[model samples]
Target chain A: MNAAFALIARDVRLAWRHPNEIATILAFFVIAASLFPFGIGPEPQILARVAIGIVWVTALLACLMSLDRLFQAEVEDGSLDLLVTAPAPLELLALAKVVAQWITTALPLIVISPIVATMLHLPADGYATLLLTLVLGTPGLSLFGGIGAALSVNARRGGALLALIVLPLTVPILIFAVAAVDAAIAGLSPRPHLFLLAGLSVFALTIAPFAMAASLRQAAE
Target chain B: MNWHRFASPSNFKRLSARIFPWAAGGAALCLGCGLYQALLVSPPDYQQGQSVRIMYIHVPAAWMAMFVYANLALAGAATLVWRHPLAEVAGRAMAPIGAAFTFLCLATGSLWGKPMWGTWWEWDARLTSVLILFFVYLAYMALNNAFDDATRGARASAVLALVGAVNLPIIKFSVDWWNTLHQPASVMRLDGPAIHPSMLWPLLAMGVGYTLLFVVLALVRIQAELIERRLGALVQARLSAEPAA
Candidate 1:
C-alpha cells in the first residue's frame, strides 16, 4: 500500500512539474471540440442535439493523444525496469501510474468541458449529465489506454497501433457513457446507464492493471 | 506418449501434411450439403418471408466469425502460458480468416437488411457492435502486419487478439442489454432453440456447414502459415550461407 502510494506520488509530482503536458492535452481537446461547431455550422438546435456525442468523442480523442505517454516514457528511461523489480506488485504500481495519467489528461478535460459545452450551445440542463458521464467514463479510458500503451511499449509506430487496439475495446464504455448523458438531456433517468458506466470502470480498473503489468513484463524482456 | 516430439519442425511438417487433405475435403463436403439444405430444403420465414432466407448465410457466418476470434484468443493465451510454438502459428493463421468471416457476415447482413428493413444499415445495438467487431478484426490484422520483426509482431498481435476476445461477449449480448431492432436469439437460448422443427433443421444444417468451413479454412491456412515460415527460414538460411558482398 505504501509503495503504490509512493509511486503514485512520484508520478503526480512528475506530471505536476511538466505542466506543458497538461496544456497540450487541453489544447487538443479545445481544438477538436471547436471544429465540430464549424463543421456543422452555428445551428444551436443541431449543436444541442449532438452536444453529448461531440464532448464524449472529443474526450476519447484527447485521451488517445496523451496515451502514448502512459508507459512510453518510463519504458524508455529505464524507470519501468526499476519499478517492476521493486517489492510492490507490478499491477498496483501500474494502476498508480494510470491514476497519475488520468489526473493529467482526463481531469483537465472534465474541468474545461462546461466552457466547451457552452461554445457548442448545449442546453443548461445537459451540464449535470455531461459532467457526470466524463467523470465516470474518462478513468475507464485511462485504464484501457494504459493497457494499450504497455502492450505497444516495444513496438515501432506504436501510437497508431495503440489507437487500433484501444478504440474498439473502449466502445462499450463510450456507448453507455454517452447514453447516460443523452438520457438525462431527454429528461429520462440516467441512473441505469450511469450504474453501467460505473460498473464498467470498476471492471476495467480491476482487470486492466494485471494486463498492463503482463505487457510491461513482456516489453521489459 | 511423446508430448514434446511434436515440437520438432520436421514432425509438425509431416503431421500437418497428413491432416490437411482430410480437413479440406470435409470442409468442402459440409459446406456443400449445408448450403443445399439451407437454401433449398428449408421453409421460408413466417414474418420476413423469403428475405429470411439470408439468415442461412448471415447468422452462421456471423457465428463463425466470432468463433474464429475466440479460437485466436485461446491460442494467444496458450502461447503466453505454455510457450507452445504452434499457438503463435494458429493465431496468425486465424486473423485474416476471421477478418474474412467478419466481412462476410457484415456483407450478407447488409444484403438481408436492405430487403427486410428497407435500408442497408441501421444504428441498432447489434449492428453497431458487429461493425465494431469487424473493426476489431481489422485492427488485429493491421497490428499483425505493422511490425518489421515478424516474431515481435506475432507476439504483440497475440496480446491484441487477447484484448479483442474480451469484446466477444459484449457483442453477443449487446442486443439484450438494450432495446434493439434486431431480435433476440431464437436458436441459442438457454432452454432450447425457440425455433420450430420445421424451420430449425435448415438453420442447423447451415450452422454445421459454416462450422466445418471455418475449421477447414483455419487448418489449411495454419498449414500454409507453417510452410510460409519454413520457406522464409530457408531463404534466410541460404542467404546467410553466402557472405555479404
Candidate 2:
C-alpha cells in the first residue's frame, strides 16, 4: 500500500517540479475551447446552447493529448518493467497512476472549465451541474484512458490508436455529461445524468485499475 | 485443460479441415432457405414497401455485427484464460470482416431510412448507438494495428474488444431504451416474432444464411491466420539459428 502511495507521491513530486506537463494540457484545453467561438461565431445565445458540448469535447481532447505519455515515459525509462515485476499489486500501482493522471490533466480542466463556461455565457444555475459532472466524470476518463495508454505503449501509431480505442467506450460518460449540463441549462434538474455519471465513475474506478494494470503487465512481458 | 489434443497443430489442422466443409455446407443450406423465404415469400412491410425488403439484410447484418463483437469478446477471454494462441488469431482475423458487416448494416439502414423516413441520416437513438458501434469497430481495428510488436498489438486489441463489447447491447436495445425513429425488434422478441408468418419465415431464412456466411468467412480467415503464424514462427527460428552479423 505504501509502495503504491509512494509511487503516486513520487509521480506527483516529479510532475510538480516539471509542472510544464500539466501546463501544456491546460494550454491545449484553453486554446481548443477558444477556437470554438471563432469557428461557430461568438453569439452568446449560440455559445450558451453549445457551451456544455464544447467544454466536454475540449476536456475529452485534452485528456487524449496527455494519454500517450501516461505509460510511455515509464516504459521508456524501464520503470514500468520493474513495476510489473514488483511484489505489490499491479492494480494498486495502476490506481495510483490514474489518480496522478487525473490530478495532473483533468483536475486543471475542471477548475478552468468555469472560465471557459463563462466565455460561452452559461448561466449561473448551470454551473453546479457542469462542475458536478466534470468532477464525477473525468476520473473515469483517466482510468479508462489509462488502459488505452498502457496498451498502446509500444504501438507504431500509439497516440491516435489510443484515442480510437478509448473514445468509443467513453461515449457513455460524454452522453451523461452533456445531458447533465443540458438538463441544468433547461432547469429540468440534472440528477439522473449526474447519478449515472457517478455510477459509471464508481464502476470504472473499481474495474479499470485492475484491467489496465493486467494489460500493462502483459505488454511488458 | 486438454492441451495435448489441440496443442499439436497438425491434428488441429486436420480436424478443422474436415469440419470446415461440413460447417460450410450446413450454413449454406440454412442461409439459402432463409433468404428464399425472406426475400421472395415474406410480404413487404405495409408502409415501408419494397424498402422493407432491406429489413432482411439490415436486421440480420446488425445482429451479426453485435454477434461478431460477442465472438471477439469470447475469443479475447479465451486467450486470457486458456492462453489459446488460436483465440487471438481468431479474434484478429474476424475484426475486418465483422467491421465490413457493420458498415454494411449502416449503409443498408441509411438506404432503407432515406426512402422511408425521407432522410439520409438520423440522430435517432438506435441510429446514434449503431454509429457508435461502428466507431467501436473502427477502434478495435486501429488498436490492433497500432503496435509495432505483433503480440502487443494482439493483446491491446483484445482488451479494446472487451471494452467495446458494452456497445453491443446498447445498439441492440437503443430503440427500446429510448424513443427513436428506428423501430423495435420485431424478429427476436421474447413472445415469438411480431412479424407475420409470411414475413417471419423468410427473415428467419435470411438470418440463417447470414450466420452461415459469417461462419464460413470466419473459418477461412482463422485458417489463413493460423498458417501465417506458423510460417512466422518458422522464419524467426531460422533467423535466430544463423550466426550474428
Highest-TM-score candidate: 2
Model 2 over residues B116-226: C-alpha lDDT tens digits?
677887555655677778888888778777766666667777877776675455334533344322245432221233767787776777777777778788888878877
Report the CAPRI category for model 2. medium
Q: Residue B171 error for model 1, in Å?
A: 5.1
* A1-221 per-residue lDDT for model 2 (tens digits): 99888888888888899988899989898899989999999899898888888989999989988888888899899999888988889999988888888887788889999998888888777898999999999988898898888777877777888888788767778878887888787889889878878887887777687678868887788
TM-score of 1: 0.89
Q: Name the regions of candidate 1 deviating beyond 4 angstroms.
A: B1-7, B41-49, B171-199, B232-245
DockQ of 1: 0.51
- Tens digit of lDDT per residue, candidate 1, span A99-195? 8888878889999999898988887877998889899988989998888888788677789888988988887787787778778877889998888
User: What are the root-mean-square deviations of the candidates from the true structure over C-alphas?
Assistant: 3.8, 3.5
